[model samples]
Target: MAGGFGAIAGLLGRPSREPRLLLVHRLDERDPGDPGDPEDPGAGPPRSLLVTHPRAVPSESRGGHTLALAAPLTRVTNAALAPATNLDQTPLVRASRSMMAGLLSDLDHDGRRFGLGIDDVLLSLLRGIVLEHPDASRTAPPEATTATRLRAFIEARHTDSRLDVAQVARELGISRRQLHRHAPDGGVAAMLAERRLATARDLLAAHRALTVAEVAERSGFGTASRLRAQLARRAGGTPKAIRQAASA
Candidate 1:
């Protein structure tokens, strides 16, 4: 989230907020992305930012913002901006990228209101990428905590109403202690409930005819009454009200 759009409107839409135009060149992890000796970050011609998403950002480097998103990064050739080149596309890669774009679109980046559900979607994509390129995946360092990984694991299976932390821990090959050590602000249960609620709202907004009962079932709230209870307790509204608000 830049203070203003800057030149990002032509590139990626505020990075944390919108997907970038991969026009002139595609982003690569190897691109030279150092903040330089004194961190002179200004909006320059062809400004490059790096996500290094999910990696632990240093505490001191955050400046004043609670969350800091580095600029976008792109590959270069011969010390010059590289031109776009053709590359092979696969369904796995395409689906991974498409989900990422959708997830980015759904989050409120400028407001810094990134919900756990979005991280759930992101971690799943990361694991999928590991499968896509086992060689490169093995070379990178693993995330220090399993909190985000748990989000992905639970999200991929959240539709199964029976999902519990214990089962998730066992499947992920980690102890429950590790799971809760770096849990999100409200912890796992809260994250799951929020995720389900988000899904329910999306279903309602997209399908005008979908009844509360249907949304509840698909979103894994199991029963309509349970869904209603959670929605009332957490969202302060009924399913119909949420649906209307979303569509509005």
Candidate 2:
């Protein structure tokens, strides 16, 4: 994570909270033969445009007031930034940036807090990059930590009620087959339903002011009757009983 927005903004002479218009150019992978000596400059003016999306940052990275790309995106990005000796923009890079812009915009307008949704969009963008540049994808380490990523995404968007495996796959820039491959024990749908139930349970137990209908909608259960049925099936209790117990 970066130190803070202040440091970055200070360099740009802008307010810490405001977006900074920073430029990143002249990127090259570290070469043993090239001592990185400024005097031995071989390349002309740098060609890459590095635009920071102020809304795409994760929670932890947000604490440091810095923007960060997910791990999968990072490797592809590094690969894209490397091997550049000229200002020539590759098709792959252009596509990735355009996808990135759309992802940022979607997450911002989707009325969900930043978390899994953001990661999903990023993963989807990474998937697109891989399609365009298979070699770049292969160069990065294998992503085997789908459990954590999926959990986070579910937790963030379970309230949408429309959240599902196919929607998630679309947002993550992957196919339904790929999504199943990353599914946890019961599968993505099961996991999402479980999360919604869990959230409803908590709301019922603690928030006396929220009616069962309100709890159901906010927790993504959609309706009180549905929330009641699920609660009886999985939680073995009614919303009223849960609230009474919590109050007592």
Candidate 3:
């Protein structure tokens, strides 16, 4: 968003029920009226695909033809979609401009909010590039433990009350049994509850003004009674006790 990005449009997803994937192709002079301006006419063209986001306006070096697709992020359960670092390549990037022209037949697929079923395919395309580091893949490929990915997912999404063990397992591309097989001693549910309780206590200590219910909501506990019960069973006797201890 800073210094007028040249063409980094398809690089990241936004916080939305459905991420918008923009397929970009080059345009030529003979094309119809001005396709419209690039997101940053001054910025360079995009390097890799982002989850669900608008296409950056094609740069002067590359003409602009965009195909937009939308699908619920939940529909994509692949661990690769969790994160993708920047992937900048040539030929495949430059000489590859024309390949996108093949998808024109499905242009009608553009702008529709749901039911195209390309979500998995789109995210999977970047799996190798995203999950495996270029420098390390050929030698010692880094395999993230299931526990690591699960913890990262929950850390990012715990505020959503709907989050549960099943959803976390799905996000990690594993079954509930597989998830438990790799879980710590107390198992997945205990891990999640611990995360929530940690957040609740931190909020109580840091923001003395927040109510027990507010702390519960922000910490993913869903209700003050739930927060209190956990605290009573765990370390904190109460939210007030936490704040008082912090002050002391």
lDDT of every model, 2 decimals: 0.50, 0.55, 0.54
Tens digit of per-residue lDDT, candidate 2, span 1-248 = 12354353244443353223222222332222445668766533323323244333233222322322334223223222222111134555445444544555676678544543454555555445445544322232355355545555675577777777889788766788877888877788888788889888888876677788988987898999988988888778899888888889
Per-candidate total of colliding backbone pairs: 3, 3, 10
Tens digits of lDDT, candidate 3, 179-212: 9998889888888888888878888887777788
Give the residue spans of candidate 3 off by over 4 A. Answer: 1-141
Once superposed on the true structure, which residue ranges of model 2 sit more than 4 Å away at CA?
1-144
Q: What's the lDDT for residue 236 in model 1?
A: 91
Worst-scoring 10-residue span by lDDT in model 1: 73-82
The digit string of per-residue lDDT tens for model 1 on 1-248 reads 22222232334433453222231112221123444444544322222212233222222222231111222221100011112222224444455444544444556555445544554454454444334533322221365246655665555566557777787678878887877775787777777788888878787777767677877877878889989999898989888887668778
Q: lDDT score, residue 39, model 1?
A: 54
Return the lDDT, model 1, position 169: 74
Against the true structure, candidate 3 reaches a TM-score of: 0.46
Mark the regions of model 1 whose C-alpha exceeds 4 Å error after superposition.
1-140
Most accurate candidate by TM-score: 3
Per-model TM-score versus the true fold: 0.46, 0.43, 0.46
